[model samples]
Target: MSAFEPRPPFYLGIDLGGTNIKSGVVEDSGRPLSSVSIETQADLGPVVGVENLAEAGRLAVQQSGLKWDQIAAVGLGSPGTMDLSRGMLLEPPNLPGWNQLPIRDLLAAKLDKPTILQNDANAAAFGEYWAGAGRNTRSLVLFTLGTGVGCGIISDERIIEGRHSHGGECGHIIIQMENGRRCACGAYGHLEAYASATALVKRAHELLAEQSTRSSLREIPAEELTSRAINEAADAGDGLARRLMRETSYYLAVGAVTLMHTIDPDIVLFGGGMIAAGSTFLEDIRQHIQKMAFPTVAKGCKIEYAELGGDAGFIGAAGCARAAFGR
Candidate 1:
C-alpha cells in the first residue's frame, strides 16, 4: 500500500556524545563504508557543537568519496531525554544549554537532507537488532553501561517510543525501594545507581576508602581509578578488584533480570565502553540471571555482549533511517 519500497543506496548516521560527535556512511545493507569522529567542544556551547556535528557529517561523506546528494537520509543518535516527534532535546544535562534544541530540524537544515533523531541508547539497540547481536532474535533489550545505564527496548522487532516519546527509559527502573545509592537522575535504588560503569568505579572507590584493600587500585590515586583500571586489576587476580566485579555484576544481573521480566526479549545485549571486561564481566551477570529470571525465559534468552562495540549508536541510527524510509 505504501509508495516507498526500497530506500536509497546509502544512509548517513551520526552519534552525538559528550566528548565527540561520530559520523558514518552506512550502505543500504548496513555495512559502514567510512566513519569519522570530531571533538564536541561542549565547552564552546551547544550551537557550536551542533555545527561541528554537521561538519563532521560532511567530512564523513567526503572521506567516503561520495557526493552529498548521494545520501538518502541522515540519522542521529544523541544522549538525554528528548521529545522525538518534535525533534527537541529536552534538558540533556551532559551537554549544558542543549535544552529545547531542535536537533532534527537543525541537522536537516544544515545537511540539506531529511534527518531522523533518536536517543543514543535506542539507536545502539536498533543497530544491534538490525545487524549485530540481536539480528537473530529481533526481540531484544539493550543496556549501554556508560556514565549511566541507557536502555533500549525492541519488542517484536519494533522500537517502543511511548506516548510522550519517552517510554523506553529502562535505566530509571527503581531496584532499590528503601535506602539505595543515588542515581544520576536524583533518584535512589535505580539500576543505573548500582550497575552502570560509573557505579562500578564509585563502588570501588568507596570500598577502597572504607578500609585498606590490598589491590592495585589502592596504589593508584583516587581520581586515577576507572572501570578499565579496575577490570585490568581484576584480570590480574587482584582480590578487591575481583570482589568489586562480583558485587557490580550482581547488580547488573539484577538489572538484566528486570529487563527480562519486563521486555521478555529473546536476548538481552550489553554494550558501551565498560563491557570491555568481556566474559569475566558477563559471566557474573549470566549466572545471576539464570538463578533469578523465570525458568523458560531465562533458558530462552541470551545474555550476550553487543557485537558492534562503540560504533553501535551511529550504525543503529542508520538502521532506523532505512527502516523509517523503507527497505
Candidate 2:
C-alpha cells in the first residue's frame, strides 16, 4: 500500500454471550470483513472472560487482513443489568459472580483501544437499523423471540439506552392482570411469559395434559417437545399445534402493539430462532396487531423479520462503535 492512500476506518465489535464470544471486524460501509467465535466459558469469571473477548477481536482483525491499529474503536455488547455511563455489569443472571465489574473499561484495557459498551439486544437492533431490515428507516423496534423475549429500540439512528440501561426492556411489560404464567425472571404477567419460545413450549405441555383432543404432538416425548416441534406439527395440520402457534402470535402482537402505541417507530422487526415459523406466523402477528392497535399505528408501522440472522450482534456492535467514534 502506498503512503498516499488514505486509511479506511474499521471497527471491531464483540458480542459476549453466556456460551460464546462472537467478534467481527466491520468496514465503514457496514459489511463485516471477518468474524471469529470462541467459547465464553463464562463460569471462569470476568478476568478470563475479558481475555477471551480481546482474543476474539484480535483474531477478527487478523482474519480481516488488517492490523490491530487499523481498528478505530471496539464495541462490547453484553447481557446484564448494566450501568451504561460507568460501563459496569450490575447483574447478569446467566453470568453469575460477574457483578459490579467495569466490563467496558476492562475490555478496552485488554485490547489497548477505545471501547464502548452496549446491551446485546440493542447492539443487534442497531445492526439491523444500520444495514439489515430497518435500513433507511428513521426509527425501529426489534423483538428477539427465543428462550425469552428481548427488545431493542432505535430512534433517529440512536439506541435508546435508558437512564439505567433498561430503556428497551419491553419483554417485562405486563400483559396480564390476573394469574399469569411465570417468567424466568420470576415475574408474572410479563410479555415474555406469554410470547417467548420457552413459554410456548410450556403452554403446549399444559394444554396437552388438559385437553383430551388427540394430536400429533402427543407422539413426541414430553422432553423433546420444542417450539420447532410444535411449529412443524402445526404445519402438518395438527389442530392443537396450530392453536398454540396462533396464541403465540397473538401474544407477540400484544407486545408489538404496546410498543407501537408508545414509541411509534417507523418499523418493527421480529427475530431469533422462532422466526423459522415463517411468513404465515408473521402474518398472524400482523393480523392481531391490526385488530388490537389503532388503525394509524398499525398501518403506519412496517412489521417484518430481521435480515441479519446470527450476525446482527457483532455487526450492530461495530455500528455502535462507528457511531460513537464519528465514523
Candidate 3:
C-alpha cells in the first residue's frame, strides 16, 4: 500500500431494544454500509442479550465486508439509565428482568473489540447531529415519540449525560398540572403520558369509549387501535381522531417549548413512528408552540422531523464508537 493512498476505517454500531437488536457498520463518511437485525429475546437472560449483541455486531461487520482490524471499535445503544464510566446499564425499564448489566465489558470480551455504551435515544441524536438533520448545529434536542417518549440532548456537539447519566429523560417532564394521566414511570402528568405513540392510542381509546362517538375508529377493536390508525382517521376528518391528534400535539408542543426554554437548543427534532403522519402532525406542533410559547422563544428555535429515519440509532452508535475510539 502506498503511503499516500486514501485510508478508510469503519466502526460497528448496535442498537439493543426490547424487540430487536439492530446492527450496522458505518464508514468514516457516516453512511451505514451494511446492516442486520435480530430478535433480542431479552427475556432469556442478560448474558444472552449481551451475546446477541456481540453476534449482531459480528454479522454487521461481516456484511460490511470488513475484517475485524478494519473496524476500529464498537458502540452499543441501550435503553435505560447507564453509567458510562462504569460501563454498566443501571436500570432499563424496556428490558425487563435486567439490572446493572456490565454489558460493555461482556460485549467487548465477546467481540474482542473496544466498546462503549450509551442511551439509545442519545445515540440516535448523535447520529442525526453527525449526519442527519442537526448536522449544521452544535446543539439540538431530539424527541422520539414511540411506545414511550425518549429524548436526547446535545450541547456544543456533545451528548449531555447529566449527573447520573439520565439527564435526557425529557419525556418525564411534567406536562399536566394536577391529576393528569399516569405515565409508564408510575408518575402522573409526565409528557410521556400524553405525547407518546402509546399515549396517542390511549387518547383514541378514551375518545371511542365516550357515549355517542361518531368516529370510524369505533369500528376497530381496542386492541387493534394504533397511533397510525388515529392519524389516518384524523386525516379523513374523524372528530374523535382529530381530538386525539390535537391533544397529543398540544402536549408535544408543550414538551418542545419546555425543552427550548431549558436547553436553549438551536433546533428541536421529532422522531419515531409518530413522524410518519407527515406535514399535518408537524404543522400542528408548530402551531401549538406559536400560540403557547413566548414569541421570542418560539422565534429562537426551529422544530422539525428527524432525517435519519429508522437507521438513526445504529448510525449514532457508530458515531459514538468513533468518538470513543478516536478513529
Candidate 4:
C-alpha cells in the first residue's frame, strides 16, 4: 500500500497558450479549488509571456484562499519542444523568438516554490491518466484536435518522454505517405495536415468553393468560417458540413489506428473543441478504427472522450510537477 497523505491543501497548474494564459489551484484529488485567466499577449514576446504566466500563477494561488508557502508547487504546460532537465523551451514554433527560456527556474523564482514544465500534450495525457478517462487503465493515448492535432501517450501509468522529451508527437507521424496533403510542419502526409481542426476548416471552404452546395455555413462570411461553425452546421444536418466532418473523422481514425498498432495502448481518448460536435464525430472515428485496426489490438482497446476538457493540460502539468518534486 502507498503511504502518501490523503490530500494536499493546494497546488498550482498553469496553461500557457499563444493567445491566453490560464491557471488554477487544485486539491490533491484534482478538483479545481480556484482558477484565473488572462491574455497571453504573445505579441509582446517571451519576456511578457513568462511574466504574465507567473503572475497568473500567483493570482491563482492568492484566489485559492491559501498562503504562498501553503501551496505545494507549480506546474506549467507550454507548446514546444522542452528540455526537461534544463527547464528550457527550445525554439517553440508557436511562440516565435522564444528560444531556450528557462521557464521552470523563472516561475520558481517568482513563486518561491518548485516548478516543472512539460509539453502541453504530454501533460494532457498525464492529466487523463491520473484523473480523467484513462483512470484505472495501465496504458492510454489521448489526442487533442484543435488548430492542430496533439498527441499524448501514457504507458504503465507513466507519461512517455522519449529521449530529449520529444516522445509522443503523434501529429507529425505520417499517415498517408506521399499522396497526403502538406502539413504546417513542412511535411507531406502528416496526420495533422488532414485531421486537425484547421484542416477541417480548409476542407470545408474547399468543398464550399467546389460546389454550389447550399450549406448554412455559406451564409456566413467566408472569413468567419471555422471548425466550430462547421460543427454547428453539422449539428443542424448540413450535408456539406457533415461530409467535411466525416472526412476529418476518417483521417483522424487512420491516425488513431496507426497509433494503436505502434503503441498498443489500452484506451484512446479524444478531446478538444472539435470534439464538441459530439458522438457523430466520435462514432465515425470509432467505426473506422473498428474496420481498420488489427483485430487483436482493436478488440482489447477502447475509445472514449476525454473527461478533463480544457483543463487537462493544467491538471497534467500539476501532476508532472508533483512527479518532478517527488511529492
- For TM-score, the strongest prediction is 2
User: 157-243, model 3: which lDDT tens digit per residue?
Assistant: 899987788878999999887988999899999999988999889877776676576779988888889999998989999988888
Q: What is the C-alpha lDDT of each candidate?
A: 0.86, 0.92, 0.88, 0.86
Better of 3 and 4 by lDDT: 3
lDDT of 2 at 95: 86
lDDT per residue for candidate 2 within 1-327, as digits (tens), equals 764333479889999999999999887778888889999989999899889998899999999888888889998889978998898999888788899989999998888888999999999999999989999997999999999999999988789999889989988999997997788889899999999999999999999999999999999999999999999999999999999999999999999999998889999999999999999899999999999999988888999999998889999999888898844
Clashes within 3 Å, all models in order = 0, 0, 0, 0
Please list all clashing residue pairs in model 2, or write none if there are none: none
- Give the clashing residue pairs of candidate 4, or none: none
Where does model 4 exceed 4 Å of error? 1-6
RMSD to native for every prediction? 3.8, 2.5, 2.6, 2.9
**Which pairs in model 1 have colliding backbones?**
none
Best by lDDT: 2
Collision count of model 2: 0
